[model samples]
Target chain A: MQVHIPLKKVVDNSYDITIDTLPKMNFDTKVAVVTNQTVSKLHLDYLLSKISAKELHVITLQDGEEYKNQVSIDAILESLFENRFNRKSMLIAFGGGVIGDMTGYAASIFQRGIDFIQIPTTLLSQVDASVGGKTGMNNKYGKNLVGAFHQPKAVYIDPYFLTTLPQREFSAGVAEIVKMAVTFNKEFFTFLESADLNNPKVLQEVIKQAVQTKASVVAEDEKEKGIRAALNYGHTFGHVIENETQYKKFLHGEAVAIGMVMANEMAVKMNLMSEKEALRVKSLLEKYNLPVSYVIEDVRKFYETFFLDKKSSDSAITFVLPLGIGDFVITDKIDNGTIMCVLNKFGKN
Target chain B: MQVHIPLKKVVDNSYDITIDTLPKMNFDTKVAVVTNQTVSKLHLDYLLSKISAKELHVITLQDGEEYKNQVSIDAILESLFENRFNRKSMLIAFGGGVIGDMTGYAASIFQRGIDFIQIPTTLLSQVDASVGGKTGMNNKYGKNLVGAFHQPKAVYIDPYFLTTLPQREFSAGVAEIVKMAVTFNKEFFTFLESADLNNPKVLQEVIKQAVQTKASVVAEDEKEKGIRAALNYGHTFGHVIENETQYKKFLHGEAVAIGMVMANEMAVKMNLMSEKEALRVKSLLEKYNLPVSYVIEDVRKFYETFFLDKKSSDSAITFVLPLGIGDFVITDKIDNGTIMCVLNKFGKN
Candidate 1:
């Protein structure tokens, strides 16, 4: 017998994102803001001045993608438990995607689940990670292989934190903006190609567009069972690169920028996408100073790493290949020979 | 500003539950059938004969309610990690309520989460533990103060396993049956009051009714947000008794048997239940040879322990009092003086 259970009852986990500034959110529960040292140094006082919680605790970890692991998740959870946080307690993920994912994961498992709010300090997180309920710590196995789809009660995105962000990181965030544009919105891609991101107005619009595209997709397939996987456009290749480089060579967005180029090569080889459109994407990425090139030492070795990705299953290796500039196809039927040809071109280039 | 995202998803965890006799369920994943030495000695080979897994493992723990603690949960998880059981694995709980709760808790947190199947050998588990997804290990803080609402993929209730169950344990299961009947089903209570439990037909009907009732309730409220809390009819006082005894003296259901009497006493004093009806309930419990009395050493100390229960919140203790023979009311408004009066009566009696 099957019962149709409706998902309603107004789950009251809501947070606001201000592209221009951060807002003070008051709470009675014990509060822990998990952040990185860089973000802490820049905005901790600004954040502290704005909020009135019962007790405010800050846990700052080293800033980098390498630190987004189980140890980090453990540290955050241990701190919460040590502080005697109850069910009503909240965690504020107050940094970039690394801090956001690790903090979100800690919230998911600490006492089997609790409320957390995202105070994304980076543009990449504001546009990408903050809106998605994906929470996890990376393991040696693969990126996001160990994660729970835990939605934050609210996400507060303040572009005020963006003032102190380095240019490279800003470029990285633009890479994600480009990813959102390429995967779902052709008009947005065209708009971005012509827009000057240096202007605050255009950057805010960019964040809004990226979040809207993500929010719409997340609403349709929150758990990545279908069209949501399209969001992993540059990620399949990016994850392999990150693993190969030990997550130190490039920023996550930069690696994804290169990955988009690699996937475009595959699309070009398969005649699924025009070379002209691929070049257009590359040119746009280069305009943002996003890395559009990476050297793959071994084609076969690189190929083997894709299977390890949690996204790839036993029967086939799923590829999210761009169709033209804004549309994409998730196909696993592409033969290895075609894939090898695309990999070889990257080597020769 | 806000986006509605569906964070919960039906995980790709589907398993068949064959209820006839017992089928051999062995797989390639590292298997750990967490059973006690007593059950292991009697039914270990019977279980092994059925389970033909790639790496069949057995970690028999000591038998008894006292053994269900954080130490056991850690040992189970440690064993799984030591055996290198990855995220895609299974843990079979092969004993009573203690084994079921501990195994389920271990699976819920092992590497953040894993799959667990319930093979309830005790009547209490088959009727109570298996239906609700409540899984946890007892800590020094209190019973189930540390737990998660982790549903098992499936439950296999093979009555053949219950044949080896001790008479005391058997009566303990009856206590849960009475609690279920009184709280939710008036007709079930009426049937139970006259039902010949020794007869196979009667026992099967009672088990089916209790399981179906519990399953339907869980399906509606997966996370104890509403009607699910009603299931804890006799658990409030029972938890205090178990804690006082260090979970050693009485079987879990036996403790509940005495707890039901205490709750009925409070109900009679509060005018929620008639004294004559309360006596009828006590007589039914006595018919099963279940304990229906306990000495309250210190009313103040016993009252303090109620606050430690996960269900109780600040300044109020929610009590599930039997309104009559087959009805219960969940309330926190039963004043302190009235509660103290009931405790005093128990001491004097």
Candidate 2:
């Protein structure tokens, strides 16, 4: 007789994202604030003053996209174990997307999972990475090749942190906001085209809008088994660009900005989007000083790299193309010749 | 304004445990059979003949409890990455509890969790570890100090693997069987007292009863937040013993066997269980040639070690005491003096 084990579990990973100044928080359990050196140097003192816990520890790692790997994860775990942190201990992810992702991944596997709170310091993370529960680390093969879908207990997005962000980084973040608008909300895209993110009130409102759009999509599909894949509006090409440059040449959002331009070109060629509409999207990105172009050295090599992407299967590369400003389609039907033709336009002879 | 992200998800981690000959299995995706050198040398061909996958690979690590660690976990992942095993790939844990646990953990964190099947070779794993979704590796702090609650997609328990198992290993597995009976099923405990596991039919029946008992407990508490901790009837003390010995002196099941005896003594002293009932339990373990005693070098040192145990908190050590043959209680109320008194009985002095 076959003995069936039914493991029925209902997990309510619901949490609030508060957009304002950093709030004074109280945690009875031990709390570890995981941040990078750059963020810690600027704001660790302020954060420490605002938070109180039974036991508080600060774990700081080097700041960069290159450090987002297993070594950094091990450092976090080693700190937790060295401090005798139990399953009840909580982790606070501070700094940018790299810190948030690594902290979330560490919390996911530390003693079989624990509670974590996201305090994304960078503009890109606040609007995108911090909202989603996707926690992982990069590997030699690709970005986030190893990870878990572990949602944080809560996400605290303080737009105040944006004041300290660099201009290029701020523009990089705008790329993600543009991504959200292009895929799901035309009105938001229209608003973004004219909106001045330099204005604090407007930026806060924009962050809220992007988060709400993402939250709805995530609520409908926690795992990317369905509609959630649309969130990768320009991510397919963006990942390839990041990999090709060894993640050093472009900020993640910068690569995505260029990726969105390439995708819009493909959409225009397929008659899914108009040339005028594509130009409008490019102009908006240009307003933020985000990169709207990349010169591909080898079109064929770039095409082959898509297969190595986590989103791609053994047979075909799945692409998310904009049908219009607010509508998109996920398809693996893009032929190799068409993809190469688009890449050739960006190719340097 | 506060934006609430409702991440409501219902996960049905249900699977079947088949107790019969190894059935012919087919998988379309890449399959990695993670086993040890010993198990592979003995039954790799037999297993390969019964399983077919699009791309099959075998990852062999060193045999023994010493190899259940981060190094082994890394090796498994490196192999998967080298083979370009994607998220859709499946892992088959093809050994005892150590192999089952590490394999399950590798699957859980490899690409943020994937599917895995358990083919437990030893009796201990077939009865206990195979049923629970508890997958982890031991660290310097303690056993199973780090892990994830990753359930297997299915479990195939074939007693035929036991034919080549060493007699010592066989007795060690019996300790876990005795553990299941004493905590949850009195009638089952009585049956185990006289059961001849050498008889294939009798062993299969015992395995079924144990798996069912474990299934019920796990179904109620997947994360061991409540009554499930009762299953750690022998593990609390066992982990300390394993750590003290550097996991060289005793097998996990053997350590647990001696731990059960120590717990029974504490139960009797607390009047939770009668001396006669405790003797009967010891006799049953002895029938399987399992160790019933361990000489403690220092009572105070042994008591302190419990604080380092994952189940214990900063102040209290949670103990699972048998109320009688078929009942148990989980409490941290047991004072240090009472614990020391029990340990003194087995003290070398």
Candidate 3:
């Protein structure tokens, strides 16, 4: 007997990413705001004041990228179970990308997924993580090695949260914003070169531009099958960098800033980007105080680290490089000679 | 700025459930056959004789329900990362329901979702677990408390595997078959009552009928929002029984068999089912040597266990009782007095 499971339905996981203000949230079902101690202490009252639920709970986790692991995921789930939360109950992610990722992962696995809303408080998360449905936690193998593509029901990005962000963290976020401009919009990149983001109005516009650029890319490929891989513009190099540095030396966007620089050198070798064009991207990154350089302790070891990344399938490492700003090319054709030559440039003295 | 994710696409996760003969499987990508010590010893050679892959790996977990936890899930994931299996890699679940659930879960979380196929050897998995996309592992809270709904790429069912199955396990599988007939198909119930499934041909047909019943139910409701939940008919009671016994005394199907009888008793009290009808269902279960009774130690404590089930949302315990042989009534309306009375009847005197 041949039984065909006829599953044909239109799935609409689409949600709005609202910037500037956090609206009053009212839920008939139980809601848990999964946050970190750092974010909760700073903004928990502000977040709690806006929500009214049949039963509301605050689950505070230890703050740090290191805390993003299975243990924390288990804690969030344990809390939900303890509170007798069900599939109808919701989770609110109320921190940086770490909280958003962990909350979304917990929501995804708790009773086979429930609704989760993102209230990303960090600059990097607001512009980059907010738009993508990628939710995950880090394991010993690599970052986001274990995760799911569980989308948020909605996203609330308030510029007000950025007021409390540290300067280095602020620059780390600008790196991601620059990534969006360098990959998709030339005019946006040009504007960013001189944009006074200190002016809150300009910052809001920059966030909008970055988010809109990401929103469109994610809209095309939600699962990162095709065009979505382009969004990993500097992430291939960045992930390896993070892994080498044990995710402590740099914030995600800061590593990506340097990763973008490393990728540009390769692009320059390929003649897709000239030295001047690469220098322009570096200048824009420097303007935001983002680190644009790193010394690879061992070029061979650094090159080998690329294979450990989840993006590298089989023996080939797919590199997303600049086709001269505002456009890009994803290729696996770069030989070891080219890779080693480019990597050796960043080698130790 | 407000950005819509724009995710409106028809997702077709539908796949064929081929019964009787296993097809010659081939994969262009890396393939890992996730099975157990028992199944692999009995049938791994037979399964390996049918497939070819770019790179093949066999991951064996401890062969019991107790092994179904985060540790096992992590083990499966760790093997995958160590093997350098990327997004293009596929997992083949080659044991019973436990292996299927864990493998599917590992695939769901590994690098945020990958493809998997189900080769269900047990009658229970072939008829029930293989059809629905409910993939998860049990936790301290209850069965399948942490999981996701990841539909398999395809499912292959071969009746040959059952020849080596233990009689108790075979009877347990038959319990699920009876569950399918009781909830939705009176004709199938009549067929099951008189049919001698000892004849391989008849058994294949019965499995077909049960799989078909489940296929249609799952097709209409994948996420268990409305009609799909009705399939949890006996499971609501069964889960509590399984929890009470710590999943040690009886197999899942045996517990569900007893649970159905408990539900029938409740239905008889509610006037939804006659005493004769309830007996008929019990007799059918007895024909397969399925357990149809349990001794509750504490009526109130036993009743409290119902809340621990993942199905019970908030404080209300939803009960699914038979409304005659081919129909059911899903309601949270049954009073605690009625529940206690029914539970006390099964209590130790």
lDDT for each residue of candidate 3 in B1-349, tens digit (9 for 90 to 100)? 6877789889888898899688898899999999999999999999999999999999999999999998899889988988999999999999899999999999999999999999999988988887788899999999999999999999999999999999999999999888888889998999988999899999999999999999999999889888788788889889999888888999999999999999999999999999999999999999888999899988788888888798997768898888899888889889889998889889998
Which segments of candidate 1 are over 4 A away from where they belong? A1-20, A24-37, A53-85, A109-112, A295-304, A337-349, B1-119, B136-154, B240-251, B274-305, B334-349
lDDT of each: 0.80, 0.91, 0.91
lDDT, residue B182, candidate 1: 82
Error of model 2, residue B348, in angstroms: 2.7
Instruction: Please state the CAPRI-style docking class of candidate 1.
Output: incorrect
RMSD of each: 4.9, 1.4, 0.9
Candidate 3, A215: how far from true, in Å?
0.8
Using DockQ as the measure, name the better of candidate 2 and candidate 3: 3
Please provide, for model 3 over A1-349, each residue's C-alpha lDDT reduced to its tens digit, 9 standing for 90 to 100: 6888989899988889999689999999999999999889899999999999999999999998889999999899999999999989999999999999999999999999999999999999999886688999998888988889999999999999999999999999999888888888999999998899889999999998888999999988889989888888889999999999999999999999999999999999999998999999999999888898899998888987888899988888999999988999999999999999999899996
Looking at model 1 chain A, report the run of 10 residues with the lowest lDDT sum: A1-10
What lDDT does candidate 3 reach at residue B255? 93
Clashing pairs in 2: A147-B112
Write model 2 residue lDDT over A231-279, tens digit each, in one string. 8888899999999999999999999999999999999989999999999
